[model samples]
Target: MPDKQFAPGCGLVGTVKLLDIGVPTTNLGAVRCGEARAYAFWARNAVAPAAYQILGSELAKIESMGSYSCRNTVGTSGPVRLSGHATANAIDIGGFVLKDGRRITVLNDWASADPALRQFWDVIRRSACRRFGTVLTPDYNAAHRNHLHLEDDKAGFCR
Candidate 1:
């Protein structure tokens, strides 16, 4: 088991844990420190409004794809190198489900949803750009068609 954490900045406040923090690249996915901050921000800022707007309530929890990058997207056809997770700068967040039994998943219903949902997602995505150094969504490219990628790159660029 990894360290259990309760991050305050993350609206989650009391709900955070690490299954494993220092596992090897082969055993555990790469994760970064900056990415953790990005995730906390996403849960606190973006996920909250998106939930209240689309699901009719604030989200109870944030589903995450813990950060760390040992390598970039597969099939890029190049030599293997450091992934976003290695720097702990990028995180792949799946989505959030509200306390009211409503779900807001980036993969399942971000774009196909109704106007309120679309607006909610848009607002959150744009807001993330302000909090994170780089924010990428399904529209940024096919690479991010499945999840919301938030990062605090040293370069200070946003997607």
Candidate 2:
């Protein structure tokens, strides 16, 4: 399992500890209830088709960079500004695992030569924008070059 923790803060007051989306997760990471709901929604509505069309397989799991990191928007070294992550309201998606035992990662596949892979990302990106309050992709900045940052704050900031 990937590293995970439950240190909560940023107006949350320790109310959230685990990101139980009501499904078994591989890395055992945590997420805010809203983020989990959005992820579940897009996984079923978008990831399934993207997986089938690109790899002719079913999506087995959605990979993430993690959630609930208490930090600033720029990262650990930056000034503290209470990112959505600080409240477990954000999730960083890095890849997807297919039932065929294939892993499609954003770091390598986001700009791959395969049209299917690119198309798959496009579909997911658009879908995320619909569900998340803030959808930051590589297009947003260098910080998001390797994953899609999904946050639900009802802020209506999607990119």
Candidate 3:
């Protein structure tokens, strides 16, 4: 989809395409992101592979809060700045669904008692960090206690 210009210095910089991230999403249906970057390739090659490696079952769908928000960065106390979402270059992952109908949510599974569950989250986070420029998990702060913020901004900040 074409980028919509909201105002001066505030809008997507490139075509916003629906990413076929190799897995469907529960809420997002189609992962819409900037086409100027390799976010889709990273999701399909890096993120999906890592997830399938540990899931042991067929991965069904990803769960996302949404993307492409026209807003500033949250959880920061300094001067406000446009967020990756402003340009559709970021995605917020909230959870996952297995083919067997099992669901894993970051809010509940990130600190799950099951070792395997914890390991799954760890592996996914690490894998995303390898591709996305900025990966923020529940461990980053309270604001992210329910989702993993993945951005392709070349910031290289992961937590």
Candidate 4:
């Protein structure tokens, strides 16, 4: 299931779809065309290139919290602006599943004791900053303590 229409009143303005990028995921995560491309590009240019050096294996799946929802930003109460998720313009990557059968989650490994994991995490974050306009990590706030929020809003925010 690549593309689907959001239910009426989902706060989306156009067509949205889950990306099928030839990689396995724990579940389907919806994203816009640009986001999909960014993910693919990151996988190809960042993850794969450093997989062996960091994880001693090939890159596998990217575990994500998925995308597309009619909701406000996390930690916000009422009357908040719609987040990129509301329009399928963002992705929340929770972890990376390596081909060596190692699962590295952001919540668990962002500050791992192992030097390789820490380095890998930072590298991915910086790489994401280069590609996405808004890249929020756990350091940004407690609300983002469990995932790397990548959005292509071109707002020039990378924290």
- By lDDT, the best candidate is 4
Residue 37 in model 2: lDDT: 77
> Which structure is stronger by lDDT: 1 or 2?
2
Q: Which residue pairs in candidate 3 collide? A: none
Give the runs in model 4 whose Cα sits over 4 Å from its true position.
1-22, 76-79
Whole-model lDDT, model 1: 0.59
Alpha-carbon lDDT, every model? 0.59, 0.74, 0.73, 0.79
What would the TM-scores of all predictions be?
0.68, 0.80, 0.86, 0.85
Worst 10 residues of 2 by lDDT: 15-24
**How many residue pairs clash per model?**
10, 0, 0, 0
Q: Which stretches of candidate 2 lie over 4 Å from their true place?
A: 1-25, 75-80
lDDT tens string, model 3, 1-159?
555688554565554555455667544422244322455665566556656676666777778887777788998888988877777777888887878788889998898988778778777787778778899999999999999998877788999
Worst 10 residues of 3 by lDDT: 28-37
User: 12 in model 3: Cα distance from truth in Å?
Assistant: 2.3
RMSD vs true structure, all candidates: 8.8, 4.5, 2.6, 2.7
TM-score of 3: 0.86
Cα displacement (angstroms), candidate 1, residue 71, comes to: 1.2
What digit string (tens of lDDT, one per residue) describes model 2 on residues 16-129? 344444332354255666677777777777777778876799887878787767877864355567788787788888888888998888787888889778888888898888
TM-score of 2: 0.80
